[model samples]
Target chain A: QKEVEQDPGPLSVPEGAIVSLNCTYSNSAFQYFMWYRQYSRKGPELLMYTYSSGNKEDGRFTAQVDKSSKYISLFIRDSQPSDSATYLCAMRGNSGTYKYIFGTGTRLKVLA
Target chain B: EPEVTQTPSHQVTQMGQEVILRCVPISNHLYFYWYRQILGQKVEFLVSFYNNEISEKSEIFDDQFSVERPDGSNFTLKIRSTKLEDSAMYFCASREVGTGANEQYFGPGTRLTVT
Candidate 1:
């Protein structure tokens, strides 16, 4: 099984809607979870990062991690058309190697 | 805010040709990484560099692939012989020390097209 799995969604939502993105992993060793947004042909931009199981809020984005279930989520409040991008979830263990395991990104489109 | 930067926004090379992708990581960051994404696949980790040496590398980072930190500010990924499957977008990322070390900042990718 893949270390991390995410829905590759072309999830379309109207502007000002709330958006939720999620990822699941099989590796319990993963201690750091991150969410990134990518535009077409661009790099993955860090959106939210959580050290372990808990919720972190920053601006319009909130990140949640559930280590027991090996699940992580990113919620976008008041999503805008500018938020249209592919959301990628990445995670790494505290092994000190610092290599990240990434999931196939979910494509999001917030229409105005 | 400082950010990572990569050279040659796009590169086209023939199969069997050699290609070198370069990056300049955040000045104060101590760790560097290389990751690649195929046309529609997930971002795959290639290698990580710290203290001027390789810390870890994935299976996809085979013998044909090598990474170097030739200077204090430059990091590079070299593919000795490009393969058709090597066509992808390559990204460079860096992380700072101390607080929030796990937070890596990524640069705009270099799209490699191997024909």
Candidate 2:
């Protein structure tokens, strides 16, 4: 299985809708979990990052990690048109090598 | 609000030619990395450099690929002989520390087109 798996969602939602993006990791050793937002033809911008097995909130975004189930999620509250982009989930092991394993990003479009 | 910067926003190179992509990471950051994302694919790690050496690299970072810290400010990736498959978006990232607590900042990226 791939180290990280994310649904390649071309999900469309109306403005102000709640958006939930998820990823499943096969490696139990992964400790650093991150969410990145990428625009078309642009680089992935780091959104939220967490190393624990709980939820972390930063403004309108929340990142949750469940080590036991190896599941991670990013929640966007009150989404807007500007939130239209590809959401990528990335992680790395604690081995200190610092190479990130990334999932195939989910493309999201928030319409007016 | 210092961020990583890469040179030549877009590059078009012929196959079998050598192309060097350049990046200047955040001045205070300690770890540097090179990653490539093929069109419609996941971003794949190419190599990581710390303490002026390659800390780790992936299988895709083969003999055709090499990375160097030419100076205190610049970290570069050189493709010895470009192949058609080398066309992609190359990103440079840097982290303040090895621990997972810190976030790795990324550059805008250089779009490479190997024709």
Candidate 3:
């Protein structure tokens, strides 16, 4: 099984709607969970990061990690057209080697 | 506000040619990594370097692939012989520490197209 698995969603929603992006992993050793945003033809940009389990909120974005279930999620409240982009979930173990495993990104489109 | 920077934003080369993608990581960062993303595919890890040596590498980082931090500030990924399947967006990333708490900063990326 892949270390990380995410739905390759082209999820479309109207402006002001809430968006939820999620990923699951098979490795319980993963301690660092990250969400990245990528635009077409550009590199992925780090958006949110969390360590271990629990919820982290930054502005309109919230990242939640459920280590027990091996699940992670990024929630975007009041989504906007500018928020349209691909979302990638990445994870790494606590080995201190800084090696990361990434999931296939989910493409999102927020329509105005 | 420091960030990683990559050169030759885009490159096109014929199969069997050698290609070198360059990067300048954050000055104070201690760890470096190379990753690649094929069109519409997941971003795959290639290799990680520390103390001028490879600390770890993924299966994708085969014999044909090499990474070097020849100078203090510059890091590079070189493919000995490019193949058509080698075309992808390559990203360079760096972190101030190797711990899990340290966040990695990524470069804009170098898009390589092998014909």
Give the Cα lDDT of each candidate.
Answer: 0.94, 0.93, 0.93
**DockQ values of all predictions:** 0.92, 0.87, 0.83
Off by over 4 Å in 2: B98-101
**In candidate 1, which residue pairs get closer than 3 Å at backbone N, Cα or C atoms, i.e. clash?**
none
What shift in Å separates residue A110 of candidate 2 from its native position after superposition? 0.3
Compute the interface RMSD for each candidate structure.
0.7, 0.9, 0.8
Candidate 2 residues B1-115, lDDT tens each?
9999998899999999999999999998989999999999999999999998999989999999999998889999999999999999999999897444368889999999999
Looking at chain B only, the TM-scores across the models are 0.97, 0.96, 0.96
What are the per-residue Cα lDDT tens digits for candidate 3 across B17-107? 9999999999999899999999989999999999889999988899999999888899999999999999999999998873444688889
TM-score of chain A of 2: 0.98
Per-residue lDDT of B90 in model 3: 99
TM-score (C-alpha) between model 2 and the true structure: 0.98
lDDT of 3 by residue, A1-112 (tens): 9889999989999999999999999999899999999999888899999999999999999999999999999999999999999999999987757778999999999999
| Best model per lDDT | 1
* Per-residue lDDT over A7-98 for candidate 1, one digit per residue giving the tens place of the 0 to 100 score: 99899999999999999999998999999999999989998889989999999999999999999999999999999999999999987767
- What TM-score would candidate 1 get against the native? 0.97
lDDT of 2: 0.93
